[model samples]
Target: MSTEENSGALPLPQDDPVVSAGLDIAMRWGAALGGPEKLKIAFEALEPQLKREHQLRLKQLDMQREATARAEENAREAAERMVRLAQQKRQHALRMTGLWLGAGVSFAMLVAGVYVARDMWWLSLFLWGPSLLAMAKLYTLRRSDPGDMQAVTLGMRSAANAAQQAPPPPVP
Candidate 1:
């Protein structure tokens, strides 16, 4: 109640009588309980439980880390499988296109050779010879390794060049 009694105490924003009364009670209780020593003993009793809880939390964190790593590895493997499947599909399409083109060209050349044989024997030889050579080249291409990127690129370039040299479609 006197200023001397509150000297060492911090100034309260509001001079609440109830707050001062509660603080006084708390100080008395603290002194009766042997102050810091009782609190230290309470904490020491709780040490083992706190350590067990900490170890459990660390184990949970480790498990979560392992799960994340496994998930990432699975995702990576799935992505790789998708890429490989796409490459296989592309190679299959190219092979099918090559087969169809080779068959059509050979058939067309044979028909033309037969039609031109009686009139121009030399033209027939030219047509049939080129068709045979083209077939032989295709056979060699099929026999070669499909995994070779350089061979695949060369084949694509040659096809592009042949397309460029081909005559344009007649206007409608």
Candidate 2:
């Protein structure tokens, strides 16, 4: 054999076509036994990649669960803060009402003390004078400002009633 044939170089075709066809068939058979068998080998190699994708999806779901829990905690805290603010407002309103009532009572008691000391002999005018003055002052205050604090409305109503129930005007 020549040096080219020994080194497995290309060879010239035979003159007979029938002999060439038979040689081609024998070469194909030899290749079927010597080379890789299955044509779907690339598809088989993708199994591990599909499993890795499933693991990544599970990790994403865990992250979403943690985020949802944090949001719920924040919402609960906001609701508690709103309730605390509402309670503070209610306490402030009650304190304002108490102050108005205390002012009304102190003024009324001071007037009564003055009248009782003035009429030492006759105890009758002393008893009615302070009450009558207090009622008159309350009515005048209400007429001066109609939209004053709502807390004093109860006392204002009683003063108005007392003024009306007093004896009517005598003939001139």
What is the per-residue lDDT of model 2 for residues 97-123, given as tens digits with 9 covering 90 to 100?
A: 655664665566556656654433123
TM-score of each: 0.61, 0.42
Instruction: Tell how far residue 26 is off in model 1, in angstroms.
Output: 8.5
Name the lDDT value of residue 54 in candidate 2. 90
What is residue 95's positional error in candidate 1, in angstroms?
1.2
Q: Which pairs of residues collide in model 2?
A: none
| Model 1, C-alpha of 35: deviation from truth (Å) | 5.1
Error of 2 at 86 (Å): 0.5
Write model 1 residue lDDT over 1-172, tens digit each, in one string. 7543756976665478897898678666657777757857867898999999999999999999999999999999999999999999999898888878777777787889799776555556656663445563574356544444455455556555755675654567
Clash number for every model?
Answer: 0, 0
Q: Which segments of candidate 2 are over 4 A away from where they belong?
A: 1-44, 120-172
Candidate 1, which segments miss by more than 4 Å at Cα? 1-35, 139-172
